[model samples]
Structure formats: structure tokens, C-alpha cells
Target: MDVGLLLLSAAVLIGAVVLTATSGDRRIARLDRRLARVEQKLDAIAAGVGVELPEPELGHVKALLAEGKKIQAVRAYREATGADLKEAAQAIDQLGT
Candidate 1:
């Protein structure tokens, strides 16, 4: 009986973990979609203003920062936007503020 109860408890715990992880993934996906929409709107606005804006890599960098990955975010920003180290660092700093 004890063994059976232990197995059931483990199964419940596993189910909870899986549910939490999937929920988080879904939330991230939803946020990504929303960010894309916002980027499109920003691009349209920039076009209307006849101003050239930097690429949308900043949004991804900001998301990485929100996830507490400062170094990785900086690297990604540099890679995506082809900015030098100093520029990437400054961009990340601005986003953090």
C-alpha cells in the first residue's frame, strides 16, 4: 500500500511539473507573437515618419534580458544586429534601464 501511494504521489508531482513547464512555453510563444505584431506596427510607424530605425533585434535582446540572461542577450544582439561589442553593451544597458 505504501509503495502504491508513493507511486501515485510521484505521478502527481510529475504531472504538475509538466503542466507548469508547458504553460510557461505557451506563454513565451504568445509573447513572441505579440512582439512580432508590435515590431510590424513600429516598422509601419517608422515608415510613415520617413525615419530609418534599427533592426528589430532589440526586442529579442530585451526579452533575453527579462529572462535574466544578460551576457547571452548581449551576444545575441551583437550577432543579430552586427553591432560592435561596445554598441551591443550600450544597447543592452539602455534596454535594462
Candidate 2:
């Protein structure tokens, strides 16, 4: 009975270690993807073809949308960030969801 209990405890410990290692690996992979995306954006900026506009506060946009001011929200976003009509519309659409 004592030997059985010891084997069970060892198995549980090994399982926990494997679970932790896999989770850590997943987290590292996610971070690496995010970092790569950021690097690509920076490269675009360095190439002088990137339209780096100031991002609007999402909270304010959400408030405007919640107040049922879709047009106003799009206009505010465009005016504040110098984004084109299509870009502003897309941004507002994303926020709406």
C-alpha cells in the first residue's frame, strides 16, 4: 500500500511539471508572435510609408457608440486621428462589436 501511494504521488508530480512547462511554452510563443508584429510595424515606419496616426481612446469611442451616436463617433475618430473615412468607419465598426 505504501509503495502504491508513492508511485501515485510521483505520477501527480510529473503531470504537474509537464502541464506547467507546456503552459509556459505557449505563453512564450504568444509573446514572440506579438513581438514580431510590433517589429513589422516598426519596419514599415522606418520605410516611411506607414500612416502612424494617434490612436483614439477606446473608452471614449465606446461611450459615443453606447449613446447611439454612430455617425458622430466616426466623425470624431476621423477628426481626432486624421484617418480616412473608410479607416474611421472600420475602426468604429470594430469598436461596436
Among residues 3 or more apart in sequence or in different chains, the pairs in candidate 2 whose N, CA or C atoms overlap within 3 Å are none
Worst 10-residue lDDT window, candidate 2: 50-59
Q: Model 1 over residues 1-97: C-alpha lDDT tens digits?
A: 9999999999999999999999999999999999889989998998999999565646777889999999999999999887789998998888898
Model 2 C-alpha lDDT per residue in residues 1-97, reported as the tens digit of each score? 9999999999999999999999999999999999889988897886797566555566766778899999999988888777789999998999888
TM-score of 2: 0.48
TM-score of each: 0.58, 0.48
Q: Report the lDDT of model 1 for residue 78.
A: 93
Q: Tell me the lDDT of candidate 1.
A: 0.90
Residue 5 alpha-carbon offset, candidate 1, angstroms: 0.6
Global fold similarity of model 1 (TM-score): 0.58
Q: Give the 10-residue window scoring lowest on summed lDDT in candidate 1.
A: 53-62
Instruction: Give per-residue lDDT, candidate 1, residue 3.
Output: 100
Point to the candidate with the largest TM-score: 1
